[model samples]
Structures are given as C-alpha cells and as structure tokens.
Target: MKKKTPGDVFDLHQKIQSELNAQEEKQRSALRRSLSETKAAFDFFTDLGHDSTTAIALTDIALANVLEE
Candidate 1:
C-alpha cells in the first residue's frame, strides 16, 4: 500500500468535518420546524383556555424531566 501524505490526511479530515456539519445543520432545521409547530399548538390551546392546555403543559414538563435524566 502507498503511504499517505500530509495533504491527503488534511483533505480526509476536512471532508469528514464538512459531512458532520451538514448533518448538524439538517438536525437544527428539523428542530426549528418542530418548535414552530409546538408553539402554534400551544397558542391555540392557550387562547381557547381549554383543559388540554393544562395537559400540554404537563406533558412539556414530563418531557423536560425525561430529557434531563
């Protein structure tokens, strides 16, 4: 096998980092979408002053606790 040069190692490192950055950007975008949806739902429930609003609040708390654990 041929020995790798410094430029080859640098190129490979840069490629891997670029892929990781792209993946992270996609995840951040998805999270933003989910957050917008959740906010809309919360506003709907809150404006109506329905019991479901309480449930939503509780569910949010539960999810927060689970994620912390």
Candidate 2:
C-alpha cells in the first residue's frame, strides 16, 4: 500500500470541515425561519383574541422562549 502525505490528510480534513460548516449554516437558517413563522402565527391569534384557552398563552410563551434563545 502507498503512504499518504500530510498535504493529502490536510486537504481531506478541510473538505470535511467545509461540509460541516455548510450543514450547520443550513440548520441555523431553518431555525430562524421556523421562529419567524411561529411568531407570525402567534401574532395572528393574538390580534383576534379568538380563544381564551390556556393553550394560547402557552404557545405565545413558547414562541417567545424559542425566539429569545
């Protein structure tokens, strides 16, 4: 078998890191989008004040917590 050079290993590592960075960015973007959509929905219910159910308050609180985090 042939021996691998340091440059080869470094190149492979850089490629892996680039891929990981891309995936992490995608996840962060998705999380932000989800928070935005949830907040919009919460606001919609809030404007109408349609239901006085406990669930409404819980959902607003949950959305706040997630967006803040």
Candidate 3:
C-alpha cells in the first residue's frame, strides 16, 4: 500500500469540516422552524382566550337583560 501525503490529509479534514457545518446548519433551521410553530400556537391560544372572554361577557349581559324583562 502507498503512504498518504499531507495534502491528502488536509483534503480529508476539509471534507469532514464541511459535513459538520452542513449538519449544524440543518439543526439550526429545524430549531427556527420549531420556534416559529410554537409562536403561532401561542398566538392562536391567546386569540381563543380573548374570544372566550368576550363571549362570556356577552352571555352574562344577555342573561341580565332577560331576567329584567
């Protein structure tokens, strides 16, 4: 078998580094997507809570009017 040269070792090291960088980028992208989804879910729940409160208040007012009649 032939011995490897320094240039060959350097190329291999660069290849490994590129692969690691790609993997790290993918992880960062996934984390960003997860955070966006979580924020959307939080906003949806907040809106739902606001709607529920408004509905309850309207219902109470309706009940009071009916009782007074």
Best by lDDT: 2
Superposed model 1: Cα runs more than 4 Å off:
51-69
Superposed model 2: Cα runs more than 4 Å off: 50-69
lDDT of 2 by residue, 1-69 (tens): 989999999999999999999999999999999878776766677677656464468677777887799
Clashing pairs in model 1, backbone N/Cα/C closer than 3 A:
none
Error of 2 at 59 (Å): 5.3
Clashes of each: 0, 0, 0
TM-score per candidate, chains pooled: 0.69, 0.69, 0.68
Candidate 3 regions exceeding 4 Å error are 50-69
Error of 1 at 13 (Å): 0.6
Candidate lDDT (C-alpha), each = 0.80, 0.80, 0.73
For residue 9, what is the lDDT in candidate 3? 98
Candidate 1 — number of clashing residue pairs? 0
Descending-lDDT candidate ranking: 2, 1, 3
